[model samples]
Target: MRIYTRKGDDGTTGLYFGGRVAKDSALPTAYGTVDEAQAFIGLARAEAEPGSELDQLLVAIERDLWVLMADLATDETNRAKLVAGETLVTDAMVASLERRIDDLSARFTMPSEFVVPGGNRVAAALDVARTVVRRAERDSLAAAAPGSRVVAYLNRLSDLLWTMARWQEGDSLTARAVAPLAGEAEKGA
Candidate 1:
């Protein structure tokens, strides 16, 4: 099939269940940001060791984002057509992220202050992915339909990504001094 449909050349995009909207509309923006986040996650996955835990988690998260995108793409009028665990972003999806966050965060020393977002290649990439997820979360919140769980999922996802980056960097996170990890410097002792 030809990739260039040219259906969107007029600055409009099609929705999931028969409708169209401006290309720059909130729904498209939200889903587009989600797509961007998924791409960054893919980049981070590329840096991870083959079949490692981080690699596996990133792959799963990427799949989840596709479900989020589907949820975002569908208009409210077509809600009944969406299948939970497939096109719908369900409560369990958000809960899974929370569990992963707890699981991963338990393995790392939580920094008391903001992270520097760069330590090693993989960690840095994951940090970028985390920020992208944050942006996606904001966009999704603005566009999400009533009772939608997309925002909640993205919110937890960013937390998980942050924890994953710290886990990947390990002690290195404590060393990277973009702002000094917690109170280690003591400031002119």
Candidate 2:
């Protein structure tokens, strides 16, 4: 099959069901951001240690993003065709991210201050992926339709990526700065 259909030469793209819309429309913007996030996640996965838990999790997330893009590409009229756990984003998908975050967050001390991203190659790549996921979350919210669980999924995904970045960095490698309590330091003296 020829990759170039020449159908979008007029700056319009096809929706999943049949209709076409401007390439810059809300739906495409949202899914395009998701695609960007998925690519960065791939980069992070490549940087992860071979056979490590981080690598495994990134692979799973990449698969999930494909489902998310499909859901986003579909028009609201065609939403009934979306199969949960496959083409559709579901509550369980978001819950799974929360569970993973909780599991990983338990392994490290919560950062008391802003973390300066970039402790190592893998961690830095994960941080970049996390930021892109944040953008995707915002775009998803804007493009959301009734019966769409994509917003919830993207929301939890950003949280998961943030937690994973911290998990990969651990305590020793995480760059953090803390401020002393107002008068506590003087009182101690």
The best candidate by lDDT is 1
TM-scores, in order shown? Answer: 0.92, 0.90
Which of the numbered candidates is closest to the native, going by highest TM-score?
1
**Candidate 1 TM-score versus the reference:** 0.92
Lowest lDDT 10-mer window, candidate 1?
Answer: 180-189
Candidate 2 residues 1-189, lDDT tens each? Answer: 999999999999998867898999999999999999999999999998888999899999999998899899988888888889798988999899999999998998878777777867788898899899999989888687776889888888888888888888886554455446769878887
Show where candidate 1 strays beyond 4 Å.
176-189
CA lDDT of each prediction against the hidden true structure: 0.91, 0.87
Clashing pairs in 2: none
Regions of model 2 farther than 4 Å from truth: 174-189
Question: On residues 72-147, what C-alpha lDDT tens digit does candidate 1 reach at each position?
Answer: 9998999889999899999999999999988888887888877776789998999999999999998888789899
